[model samples]
Target: MSTETTLIKQHVIDPEICIRCNTCEAICPVGAITHDSLNYVVKADVCNLCMDCISPCPTGSIDNWRMMPKAKAYSIEEQLKWDVLPAELSAEELAAAGAEVGAAQEEAQAAAQAAASSASAASTASASGFNSAAYGATIPPWSAAHAYTNLYGPKAAEKTITATVTGNLRVTEVGKQDGQQDYDTHHIVLDFGSMPFPVLEGQSIGIIPPGVDAKGKPHHARQYSIASPRNGERPGHNNLSLTIKRVLEDHDGQPVRGVGSNYMCDLQVGDKVQVIGPFGASFLMPNHPKSNIVMICTGTGSAPMRAMTEWRRRLRASGKFEGGKLMLFFGARTPAELPYFGPLNNLPKDFIDIEFAFSREVGKPKRYVQDALRDRAADIALQLKDPNTCFYVCGLKSMEEGVVMALRDIAQNAGLDWEAIGGALKKEGRLHLETY
Candidate 1:
């Protein structure tokens, strides 16, 4: 009388040959591989057997095998229900995790204070802004003509404009929500009219303009991930919106301005700015029936998170999506710097696991997103068990190592094989890093 269709089971990973890259953890459309501080295990129920995670492994350690003949097949409904944890953690677990974060916060605060004092002393002795000569050579936004043409196509009509004192555009909405500051959220409207360029979620676009930098030279074209989902940028619509933040400093602890970010931050609603590209290849989300996503980011890196979340939210509201778990980890200098603070807090807190690490806040000395991951090692490890889980990390490049280190610690603490877990992550693009 029961008409539930059974799903097939399989052994998609070969332990003997696995190199432990953690790729599978980050790439699986569903969170299926349970990775810890030690070993990466596959959770069969959530595994769709799509085999999308096999190709990215560098050492070919993953081996896909059918479930044994004796094993009972489970229905899709049953499979979907397999890994759903109670969404409740014991009071002890929550307390321990909170304590760990508190300690880390203190350390981070101390370090930030030290750095701030040093910076203040240095600033008093020198010019407030960056010294243009320190950098190898500065280029104004206008000099990058080639970058502009490449993004819009070689034959596209070329238009150039410079940013001036009177013409400078002030930012308006910095994407604010409750418990969040009025951060710099600038909205740009792109009117495609009849010649609109379309983009999907996860796609990136390039921007090249004619503005000159402080060095009296043209600046370079910059690339940013398209935050708007494809559905939002539909045809016949004259405009597209982009949420951007200005990059104020370079990675080397030196004062340097980002060409695109600075210009983007200073634009008005009516400003006609040069635009190019939607250029990215390996970092898109799968639109498969029941895709799972594990997103990790720091700072303004939450842009992509916003895109993917918005897309999923739309699908959920329509009741047409057979979606999987959506885990998001976002880090920032302080709670104040978080991009989508209020909305992040509002997401079905049950479905979306939000973790925070304030690097400069008073309590912590140098805490980061990775540290938060380590604190939640058990839950994270369990998520990795689902071979369908696709993990994504974006934000500061410096945070990559820390995150990896935290994963390693989680594996060790959980008795997982570190090499195997890490290998699977890299092999499956489960450990995507997009820090620049």
Candidate 2:
């Protein structure tokens, strides 16, 4: 076997920061990404470093990379089992490992060469063919107001800040009388007393739950999007709101209560909680006058959308800003399960155009946010062609593909070149996706 030494950069997910959003997995073109209940992992051998999954990741956990000998790279199984990423092998250790696997090193070298060549070829081609527009905006809209991010957290001097739980109320209607499905969601307000915690509309905050997990390690912070405007949840106060769903079961329907959700849901007034972040610099709304906004979301994904909408509402109410069209396509299992249903109805039709899609509404055909988009294809197509229009998609990971495909269909049906339009959208930062 040839003794060619091959160096490769191995991408790994940071388990500590990852929220298990599945955004990276869904956007990965080569199926190099996969996730378990606890972790999202990248298969090193399959990943060609296309950089497609990097931009859409909400937490920046998917940005970790380790450089080592090709033969010493971690496998998918190894990554899935890791609680924390393994320390990078030293130069001597990498050399020893490579030497031990003589034939394996040759195989790895071949694979590395093949992957590099493929990646190079892909780099030369236009990325518009990959439907990257669906992955969402990596950069905020050009006209967006200044946002303060990472003001506090792991990267900052202060480890964490404390916030008082000023308000906690159930947003979704749930009870035996409501239905068999007891889906619970809460609108939580946090007040940062005498502290400077500046946050923008699309940013998120990390809530550190009280105790340790089953592994006996301190529970890592969980991120929730800011659901209220920058001014405050109630206006002119140092506070923000979050829309948190009480997760009673796992994605597989197994009875596993979520750590953070349960803790946040059970919070009482005046209770103090440890907080971090104001994470996310992208996925923000346009602040320029008459910049049309389109929001598509489901469940708690409505948090950021609500923030932007409320901010717009506040701006419109002030009569200082002449706003543009505001359209929302929100989805849920049913009307009762939808958060902020009653309040959403009270908004004037002239201020915003709202459409709800409920997949499990009794006696009605199943519908989703994508279906709503399709129903309004002509209008969406017109918006897509507008230079001032910006689109945002958030919610479940399952919705990303369908919503993106709907945009593609809309562009095509309108006699527009999807590649050109998609390229322009991404280049201009007009489309953003935040599905988890």
Candidate 3:
């Protein structure tokens, strides 16, 4: 490909919709995608329009494309400074940049053909390195109830909604007195009085912290999974809950506090906060009769899992729906570190099959969520073949790959073709992964 001679489709990230989840950056095969603390940008010089990063992105921010002469494509430096995407180049500008009108059209067609070929190749790849889009569901499950999304936030014409902090309680048992590490996690409730902010299980919302960043720019929003059921945290009210962990250090071990998490955790009862989105359109629970749910999660990833579980519990209590099996495989460093440890135990054993894996418990061998899944492989394998069964995985980013691999192994060992089953899982919206 000539660097400056041809016209091409340029990939760009929409900073407005991006939650800075790092999904696009992680999945990009070429080193074309990079991000700072504030933005994720694609280097036009490096991107081949492979589309590997598109479907993995929870938000469709990475799906944007603009046509321009290759030489006129936005540089990485320019993209990093962008708060919003620049307008597409005009036809006259494209012609003036390099090629004439006829030649530009020909080149653009060639580029489109090349992108199509790359996409075809991606679909036929081996099951071991499968395309995430092939096996990741974008639609809510068939029986999922109608969910209200984007009632507030950037996409909404109205200003962001405000919610009162109804409650904030530390969920994790951390401290020297407890003989555990000094890490803290909080379960928070936000009440949206008289606001029509309806949400389903497995959805997330963004919180815009009350101040500017160190650069004196307005702080961007941070997304957190909704931990309460659709009805409300306390049932039949306009409220929701969030599971937030205080971020005292960056991923690089630097002592930089997280802007959103700290602000949320430090909230007092009756304090109001700006909120946006009931974000995710997918990753929802199936509402059909006899539908089984298998939830796997670690850390705060348990937020959405808790929502689904609680909703199922509520349904069971109402005696209106004949629910199917509900299985949970949760992992943490210790029982003390697990959010909702005591409350989870209080759930009736017959209602949900719950297993806890503790990796760092003293005098116990390390066990991950995958380990628990393997131990219960036969049950999970049966579920994999069942059309009514749905699998949800959330939590730490590190757990995503392992959990998927374990699912693959289970399917194959059960005498099923992994590729076919994986495709069906996605096609039927039976598998959902939401890791950060």
Candidate 4:
């Protein structure tokens, strides 16, 4: 092949479908994936076609590829500015661009080989590191309902679906005047009047916050886990809900406004917003009768937990489904900080078993979700033994290690082979972790 016929297989993330979940960036072994406030972009020069970021992506957006002339491969800066993936180069266009068909075939085979080698090296390094993301599954549960995604996005005929704010209510308590920390979480509901948007439990939707950033470019959409069941937040309504916490302070106690969080939390009833995606297929709930669900989450992470629980609850309420055990291990700084505290307590023990961990209650020891999991190791061990049980963990990235470690210890103490069990969990799509 002549030098001009050299073709490069460029890996890319689909900005339209991408939720900016940061999973791809975190999993990329070579640090080739990066993001600005606008979009996540892959550095062409650094990427090794390793495929590490492909499976961990909940949105399926990281699997995109474009064949380009070696000299004309897209730059990270160009990819960052994309609202949608550029059109694929047809055979004629490729040839005109000086890439022969046979050369393209050779390039693809070479790319595959490179991907396999990089994947092998990544796997070996990952085995030595305690990466919880390694345990995440890419496939949906066998009994999961069909999920609809990317119905409206930048590349679609309709750029976005307009959702009207039906309701916005504060779910947590207001802080006192004496410099008390405010746990300001809002339960916002949006109604799509006539849009054909369908979603499932554990899925997410992207909200394009109004206005541009400091760079004067349009704000990229932000993904939020769906907090409502598949039926609807209000059954039979063409609507859904999200649990959003206003970020008045950063992790270091420094005040900073979260562009997306603030935009979502401040929405009033009847306000209009642009939305994209019903992203995520893997994190869905198991729909088979007697399929047990083990949900572990914290703060806003409870959004998808609520979706799954409510879905199961709705099914049980219908009296047609004989559901299995539903277990929830939820954590918060205090009882007051917990979302749906009143409603969660109101749930019948026969319907769902809930364990609440309060880390900052004045009179109580700082019990976290992992501590709560260990406290009920007997029950957790039983669930682990059951082939029908599926475990779901979602929370801050800091909580992932401890929660997974707790499960590992529980398995080991029960004389279970963790390697086999963990492998089975991933292979069978029984264990899911979503943290950022």
Candidate 5:
């Protein structure tokens, strides 16, 4: 058929500097940016010139620039694949090239059609669905093919940034408030500026140390959610904090060394180490005003919860945050492993509702966070009545099934259908689960 020309732009992405975090690809407004193992590039035809993809790039690897005029303008085939065969190439080669181009055009057409139709239709809501919009399957604001490269022409990448340990990385704060022997919580403050590391609240980073396991293989990186809010650190400088638990060895009782937690806990103030990331987008907390938050977590899963809670606390302290209620449900093994136990308890009861369940506490049967949730079924049901409430669940990967069951039960006990509420939560991006 025919093609229409949109604005021409280039993404200046420097592979050297790019962290390959995929943030640019994740935030693209159109389905244009794509990548192979080596590089990420923009599809000229699909580029929308939105330029929204640049800000989140940490290394500033993305640069949007207009195509220069009077430059050597080559056809798509020539510009893309500079090394060309003679026009006398075999018929088979010509046929393959033609077929490839035809396939690409067809795919683009299909994507465009999906975008238009999905935007107009009502999508099905389901627990398995990524977004109800996908039910209708509309073109998402961001897609796998879309990337930040469209606005900024690709450029040379800078070196990937890494966290260096240079200062006192000791456990500055530890344990619960009021001498609660019930938990093993610790608020560890790492001096990043002296060590000079920096991070954001919702962002996560990897922790690793030099060592091979008993199996003789080097350990892989471990990602941890940053407990401190972005602003908590200086604009370009700050301290990092984490609430960690020392995991028990295996069921066999052999001491299992945690790849990250053990390394973090073992560090002295003067020790140096390697750290990477601040990874995750789906886990980010909404910063909108009047937004309500429902946090469901167990153990160190409370890391992000702490970040969100403290951010709100800071805002409230400024006497300007007049927003929705923040409900927190934290769980741990026998209460001894629930980090931030004391600070969480000290929050004004009016501003937050804290619920705890000790899954392994002695004489009584084990009561998990899910059980606590069941007890508060009425409260959860009422709070969920406000569509604005965002629900977050985090902790051990194994706890997911139990927590989900608890949510379902909470729905059933409240006289509301689980499927409907669950679907609504997913559709509104209110229900978030982070484990493993």
Candidate 6:
């Protein structure tokens, strides 16, 4: 078979930086993105360079592109197997590989135009649809601190930083042996010792599980949200905390253990674990004074919320800063299932306003986080209009649409312009959604 001479700019995701958060997979209009338990990849034939998945990515990994011969473009299969992106081929190398290097620009532009034309008609309806992922901002707020990412990564990662486990405790009550939902989450503390792994409030760390997959390759890194303030999990120590749920069952109600979550939950205090990244940029909390935060979450999604709240609490305790209102809406099946239930309540009422929704109580009516949002429609409407108030929603994938729709409904009922409000949220980095 003969190969084509024209070169095409291939859109690829950097697996090293990607957190497997599912944002890109959700936002890609043409279904170009897909993922397994390992990595997320873009299909060369399906991807049209539509660029819709670029901005909503929290880690900025989806913005990478490589010029390659169209006939020999990287396939989704090849990409999913990569631990790191292949180095770019030079012009001479491209020509030697049966591509016309000089025609790269012309072919790239043509592909882009065709993609735009095909996606144009659907864009209008997509804009009108209520996609929470669409409203997710790709940048941090104006007052957010400088977050450092990709400081250390794969490729010579054997020499990368490793942290010692200092503390491991169960935060939630023990569930029944047969899954009665009593919160099987653990609070794990990792001490970097003398090494520097600077992470922000919303940033995540990639832990390489000490095992291989069914394919016999090393298990890819799993991302977990940091659950402590940036200063340290314990004050003044070189440590951080992670809230990890022991995955005993798959989403299908079958007995299937999660490789990464189980490995993390079972670590001992003296164990050493390989770590990489301090991934994420756009999901960071604002550092300026008097900036409000509204957090809505379910289950272990409360990890990042804990980080931001603790940081603000520390600042308030120091008496050096005057922080604004902090409101939290946390949902769980029962009180015992909620991680940090005791600590979250122990926070001063004057310092924070919290709402809890329990849907599976024995006798009470079912209530979800969205129902709580509607119950506080008036207050939420006010916050919706406040520029200083940043709204963050993190939880299961199923909760994303309902929560975003709740926000839209609140805006509409208040006689506010939802179009303008939603647009500003994306443009000004006021809304962040991180559902797995």
Per-residue lDDT of 130 in model 5: 28
Across 1-436, the per-residue lDDT of candidate 4 in tens digits comes to 6656678788998886777898787656667888876789998877788787786676678899988787788998899888778999898998898888775768776976877676644643444466666666768788988888767774452678999999999998876312654548999999998877899998888898888878786777788999999879999999999999887766567777888999999899999999888788788889888899999999999999999999888888898988999999999888877899999999999999999999988888899999999999999999988989999998888898789889989999999998778777878889988887
TM-score of each: 0.57, 0.88, 0.92, 0.87, 0.60, 0.90
For model 6, the stretches where C-alpha displacement exceeds 4 angstroms are 1-6, 15-19, 55-61, 69-72, 81-100, 113-128, 177-183
Q: Is candidate 1 or candidate 4 better by TM-score?
A: 4
The residue ranges of model 3 lying beyond 4 angstroms of the native Cα positions read 1-3, 26-32, 45-60, 101-106, 123-134, 155-158, 176-181
**What is model 3's C-alpha RMSD?**
2.8
| Segments in model 5 whose C-alpha atoms lie over 4 Å from true places | 1-186, 191-199, 212-218, 233-237, 250-254
Q: Model 5, range 1-436, lDDT digits (tens) per residue? A: 1122211233345543344445466445454566543344555555444554555454455553323111221233433332211133233542343333344335545654565465323223224532212211111111111211211111211112334333322222344423432223344554444433444455666554568645564443455677877665322356666666654354345555455666666556566555555454455666676777888888778888988888788888889888678888887665555566666778999888888888766687888878887888888887667676777777765666566767777777878887678766665666766654
How far residue 374's Cα lies from its native spot in candidate 5, in Å, is 1.3
Go through the candidates in order and give the clash count of each: 77, 2, 0, 0, 37, 0
Please write out the lDDT profile of model 6 over residues 13-77, one tens digit for every residue. Answer: 89776767787887676668899877899998878787778866655788999988878889888
Q: What are the per-residue Cα lDDT tens digits for candidate 1 across 252-315? A: 4455555677677776645666555544434556565355677889866676777777777877
Tell how far residue 240 is off in model 6, in angstroms.
Answer: 0.9
Provide the overall lDDT of each model, using Cα atoms, as 2-decimal numbers.
0.53, 0.81, 0.83, 0.84, 0.55, 0.84
Q: What is the lDDT of residue 85 in candidate 3?
A: 83
The 10-residue segment with the lowest total lDDT in model 4: 119-128
In model 2, what are the clashing residue pairs, if there are any? 136-433, 137-432
Q: Whole-model lDDT for model 4 versus the true structure?
A: 0.84
126: Cα error in model 5, Å: 13
In model 1, where do residues sit more than 4 Å from their true spots?
1-189, 212-218, 233-239, 254-257, 363-366
